[model samples]
Target: MEKNAIVDLVRSKAEGYFERGEFFCSESVVHTINELLGWPYSEDVVRMASGFPIGMGKSGCLCGAVSGGSMALGMAYGRKHGEPMNEKMFPIAKELHDYIKSLYGSTCCRVLVRNYEFASPERKAHCVKITGEVAAWIASKLLDDPEISQKINPNFK
Candidate 1:
């Protein structure tokens, strides 16, 4: 079956960014979204998602696409963890998760689908599709207006 049009749109966007060495999960998300929408590439996206440390090595510890989308959301709306969510975060997080998981099943890095680290498939088309679409959906929703990034964690700022 063919995928949703919007989902596919975002997926394609994510893939283009991935091709450009935007490998880190969280920052790659911003790169994917912006590049998809014709926005300029910037290092700040990488700087922000890297705030939490991303040593997962593409092992699927947490789905890179999911982590990327989550980071994108955080970058646009402020961080969601380490404090009481101010009424808009929890639902948004769940909603985002539901959107991606419904399409891809599980979001666990290694479980829903294997990671590149495992060499599961060379240029795995389906995995790329899932990750890309997930990132696009996140950008379409959370970053629809394209706000500037803020320090998600104060100490990290």
Candidate 2:
């Protein structure tokens, strides 16, 4: 499949997972990216993203999708113990943060969904959209950058 096609698929799956209540925002992004990257981490890897939902467990701080996207970036670029940090990690993560911030003015989940009731369909749909968008954005970053793609998953194509 074409790279864009793959990105779209990732977005759809991430959205579906959240829309179906299978996972929250951060978990959806982490799960989708981890799966797409061919399970570089174990299945238990998603556990780390569990607490980020509802803006850090309803504290309403960072957007959960953004947090998950950062985790996905780490999966791609983070270094192992004793290895120097990957040079591209910070810039790529900043790009994800800036991308969402530019679109919504804030990465705060409370701020983004403030107009809708927390339990309302509107809020869920809004979060679902953000989740999918972030997943697709990360998918594109993973696929388009040959250097990063090769490093993370040489068999991605």
Candidate 3:
């Protein structure tokens, strides 16, 4: 599929996952990206990301969407054991962080959802949109950057 098409698909799937409350923000983004990439879904990934929701369990650290995007980036670009860490990985993560910061002016989940009732329908809807946007951004980067895409999945196009 084309890059835009894949991004659209990922965005749609992420939105669906969020709307259905099947996963929290971080898990939703990571799982949807993996699924769209045809990668094996791992419960480990979901479990690992669960604590990041509501801004690190509502303590309000980094946005879960941003954290989830970082995890997705790691799955795509991180170095394996005995291998030097991939130099490209940090920049990609930084790019994602920058994008989110530019969009929301802050990466704190509390800041992003300020004044919204916790877990209210409005809050959930806002989070769903963020989840979709994060997934779409990652998918777009994977599809557009040949080196990164090939590193993640040699057959991806």
Tell me the whole-model lDDT of each prediction, alpha carbons only.
0.55, 0.91, 0.81
The list of candidate 1 runs beyond 4 A from truth reads 1-10, 20-25, 34-42, 48-55, 79-86, 114-117, 120-123, 143-157
lDDT of 1 by residue, 1-157 (tens): 1124544556665665555555544555666555443443365556655532132554446666666677565545555469665565566667788887787677675666544544444534555665677676764564334342221122210
Candidate 3 C-alpha lDDT tens digits along 22-77: 88889888887776555755646777788888888878889888898899888778
Candidate 2 C-alpha lDDT tens digits along 71-110: 9999988999999999999999999999999988889999
Backbone atom clashes (below 3 Å) for every candidate: 4, 0, 0
TM-scores vs. true structure, each candidate: 0.61, 0.94, 0.89
Q: Sort by lDDT, best first.
A: 2, 3, 1
Residue 5's lDDT in candidate 2: 82
Clashing pairs in 2: none
Candidate 3: the clashing residue pairs are none
lDDT-best of 1 and 2? 2
Residue ranges of candidate 2 with Cα displaced over 4 Å: 151-157
Q: Please tell me which model should have the higher lDDT, number 1 or number 3.
A: 3
